[model samples]
Target: MTTRSCLLPPSIIRPGGRPLLSTGRAAARAALIALSGLLWVGALATPPPSSLRGADAACVNCHRRSGLGSIEGHIAIPPIAGPYLFVPRGERLAELGIPFVDTARINHDPYTDESLARAIRGGIGANGKTLNYLMPRYQIDDATMAELIGYLKGLRVSPSPGVSTSVLHFATIITPDADPVKRRGMLAVMNQYFVDKNNAVARTKAPTLYSSHTTMFRVERRWQLHVWELTGAPATWEAQLRKHLAAEPVFAVISGLGGSHWGPVQRFCEEQSLPCLFPNVEAPTGHDSDFYSVYFSRGVLLEAQLIARELADAAEPANRVVQVFRAGDVGVQAARDLQAARAHSGQQIVNRVLPAHATSKDLGAALRDVDAADALVLWLRPGDLSALEKVSPPTSRVWISGEMGGLEQAPLPASWRAAARMAYPVDLPGRRVVRVDYALSWFRIRKIPLLAQQVQADTYLACGLVSETLNHMVDAFVREYLIERVEMALDHRALTGYYPRLTLAPGQRFASKGGYIVRFSDPQGPRIAALGDWITP
Candidate 1:
C-alpha cells in the first residue's frame, strides 16, 4: 500500500492567541510525549492482514452504520454493493471536474471509474451534480480509490424499463356546486352514451327539451352546437304533459291532464276544444269500446302492430312465437293478431300477461316462468322497457317491442346501451321527410328562420311512433281544422322521407299501418329495420 500524508496547514490550525512554535509548547509538549510511547508499542505489534482491508469498508462505515453521520430525517444511505460501485462503470472521473458531478453525462452513457470518483468527491458524475444536499465528499487516497473502482467493475449492469410518454385528459363534467366526484361520474356516463371512440366531441349540449333548467346551464358549455333548455318541472306528470305538448303541438287535453295542477292547461284547452288537439285520456281501462274521447286510436295501434310484424319477419326467426302482452284490451288485441298468425301457419301459440306497472324484476321472473319461447312481443313504456332490460337474462331472445323508440338522453348508462333496443314508426328529424316537415313546421308556426338553417346543418333520423303519430295528427288538423284543405289530394303519396303518409281521412290517424324493430349489432351499431302495414287476418 502507498503511504499518504494527512496534515492541516499552519493557516488552517490556530490555537487561542498562540504564536507558531518551532519548539514544543505546553499542550504540544504533553501530546507529543504521550504519542511517542504509543508509537513505540504499535511498532512492536503486527499490522492487520492486507487481504482484510477491503476498499468498500470506508463507504460501509458511514452508509451501513446506524447513527454515524447519517443525513437528518432521511433513512440510512444505501450500500454501493453489487455492480454499481461509488463510481459506476464506463464513466471518466476527470470529465466530472472538481466540484460538480456530471449526473446528466453519466446518465447519458454508461458508468465508469472516473465518473464514480466524480460522483463521490465532486458531488456529480458525467451528468454534473447529484441530487440531495447532504451527500458528503469522500476523503481517500488514490490506491484505495483504484481498489474501489476495480471491485465495482466486477458487478453486472441492468437497464431499467422505459417510461410512458402519453398523457390522460381525464374527461369530466362540472355541476353546480355538486361534489366533484359525482360530477365526474355523471360525465363518465354521458361520455359512454354520447361520445364515440375517437372522442371527437368533448361535450354536447342536450336539447333543453330534455334537461332541467339547472342542468341545461351547467351543460351548455360542453355542448358543441345546439342549446335547447327545458322549461318545466322534471319527472312530474305536469312536466311530462308539457314536454309532450312542446314536442307534439297537436296533443289534445285528454282528461286526467288535471288533478296534478294541470287544471290551468286543461281548462285552457277545453275552452278552445274545437281548435286544440285533445287526447282521450279516460277511455275504459280494459274495454274495447271505440271511445274517441281521450285515447289514441286503434288505427295507431294497428299501424304499430303492422310495423312490428314486418320487422319481426325481417329479423327471420326459425320458430313462430307468441305475443307477451299486458293484461288489458290492447294486449288482447295484440295477442289476437299473433293468434291469427299462428292459426294461419298452423304453429303452436301462447301468451304471457302482466300488470301495467310491472317491475323489471317482475318481468324477468315472469319471462323465466314462461314455457320455452322464441321471442317476446313487448308492449310497454320506455321506463318499463329499461327496467325489463335490467332484470332480464341475457339470452338469444329477440324482442319486438311496442313503439318505444331509441335512446334520446345524454350520459346514457352502459347497461342501457347493452340492453335497450327497439323501434319507432316515425322518421327521425335528421332524415329527409322528417327534416323537411320539421323545417316547414317551424317556419309556419314559430316563423323562426334560424330553425330551418339548423335543421339543414344538424338533424337526426330517428323518431318515436307517438311523435310520428302526433305529427300526422297535426298535419291533418292543419289541413282540415285550420286550412280546410279537406279535398284529398288525388295521386298524393306518402312523403318521400317521412315514415307515415301525409294524407288523412275522417278519423284515420296515420299511414304506414306498421312500426319498425331495432336491434343491437356490434358491426352496424343500433339498426332499425322497417315493418310493413297491419292487415286483418
Candidate 2:
C-alpha cells in the first residue's frame, strides 16, 4: 500500500462516531511537539507525539541521522525509512531498492498508513507485538502524524553529493600559514593512502548471493583526494574553503593541515555540514553543539589545563607566575587559560607578550622581571628558544610548551635546560620510539624529508584513522553514519600513534585525553625526566 494509505486523516473517524480532529488542532499539536513535549490530556484519544523532545530523545536520536538506525547495547533500533516500512509481505527488501541494514525486521507484515500510525501512536509493532521500551508512545493528531511520517520518509532518501557507484571523492585542506614541511608530508600520506585503497582489489565483484535488501557483494570503489590549499589571510580562509568544496564536491575531508588559526576551517565545516575528520592544528576550534568537525586533541588549550594541574600539585606554590608568548601566536589563548586557572590560587599572574618577529633583545626584555621566586612559562618557537641564550637566568622553576618549542629538541641554551619543565602532550620519546620509527620508515621509503616529525606523525595517524573507520562502514556510505562509526570505533583502536589512548563519545570530539609534565634530564641532549604522571584536564 502507498504512504497515503498509511496516514489516517481526520476525514476517516472511527466507526463508534468519534469526532474528526480539526486541521488547526493537528497543526497546534505539531507546533507543541516542536516547542514543548507535554500533551493536552483533555483532548482526544490520540497518544503523545512520537517524540517527547523534553523527556525521551527524538526518534532521530536513536534511529540516527540516517533512518538506517543504530545498535545500542544489543538493542537494535530498526530502520524507519519509507522503503523499509512499506515493503510488501512475502517480498524481499532486495526486491525494492532498499539497502540492507542488520536492524531491518524480516518475517513481518508490511505496514500501511493505518498500521504505521498505530506503531507511532501506540507501542505496537506491525506484527502486533508490543514494542520495546525504547519506543515512545506518542499521542499525535492525524495531520501531525502524517507530517512526521512524511519527514521520516524524506530523512535520507537522497544520496549525498560526490558519491558515485564506483568512487568516493574526498578533500583535504591546507592553510597558507601551515608549515610547508608538514603540508607536504600530509599530502604525501593522503595520496599514498588513496592509491593503496584503489589498488586493494583487482576488479569489482558481482552479487554472488542475496538476502533481503540490495546487493550482497563488494564494489571496488576508487578513493579520490583533492588538496585545497588556501592563500591570503585567516579571515579569507573560509571563503576559499567554500569555493574549493563547491568546485570539488567531495564526500568528506580526510586529513588536513592548519596553522595557528583553525577556527575558520572548523566554522566552515560545521556550517557546510561536512565531515572534517581530523586536522593537524595546535589550537582547534571547539563547540559541543557542532557534529561535523572532529579533532585528535584540544591542542595547546589542553596543555594549559595540564600545567594548571601540575601547579596545583606543587609542593610549594610560587609567589608569582609569568607567561611569555608572541603577540599573534596561538599561545595568547594558552596564556589566558593559565591566568584563569590561577585566578583563585592567590598567585600573582603576569603576561609578557613579545611583538611578533621580535629580536633577541625583546625576548630578554620580557624575562627581565621574572624573579627567583617566580615560575616562568615560555610559549615560544625554536627561534625564541635560541634567543634565550642572550638572557641570564631569572628563575629556576620554568615551564615550556613541548608542542611549540619542538618537544625534547627545543633549542634551549645549556644554562636554561635544567630550569625548563615541558608540558608533553603525547607519549614520551622513549615510549613512542617504536611507533614513531614506523612512520619514519615509511617516510624514508617514500623519500620524504623529516622536517616536521610530530606534524607528519599526526597527519599519518589521521589518515590511518579515516581508513580504519571506512573499513568498519563496509558499504554503508552515509556522511552521518561515517561520523557515528568513527565515534564508536575510536575506543577500540589499539595503535593510536602518538597518543597512549584515544577516546570519544556522542558529545565528545577531542579524542586524545592527557599529557605529561617533564624536564630535561641534564644540561644537554634529548633525555628528559617526567616530573609527574599523565594528566587529563
| lDDT winner | 2
Tens-digit lDDT track of model 1 for 220-293: 11111111122343234334444444444331221111111223333333232212222211111212211122
**Runs in model 1 with CA error above 4 Å?**
1-300, 307-322, 328-333, 340-343, 370-373, 392-397, 405-423, 428-484, 487-500, 505-509, 521-537
**Candidate 2 residue spans exceeding 4 A from truth:** 1-56, 90-95, 201-217, 344-346
Quote each prediction's TM-score: 0.33, 0.86
Whole-model Cα lDDT per candidate?
0.33, 0.75
lDDT tens digits, residues 263-351, model 2?
A: 89998887676889878888887765567788888878888888888777779888788899999787988889888997899888899
Which TM-score value belongs to model 2? 0.86
Clashes of 2: 11
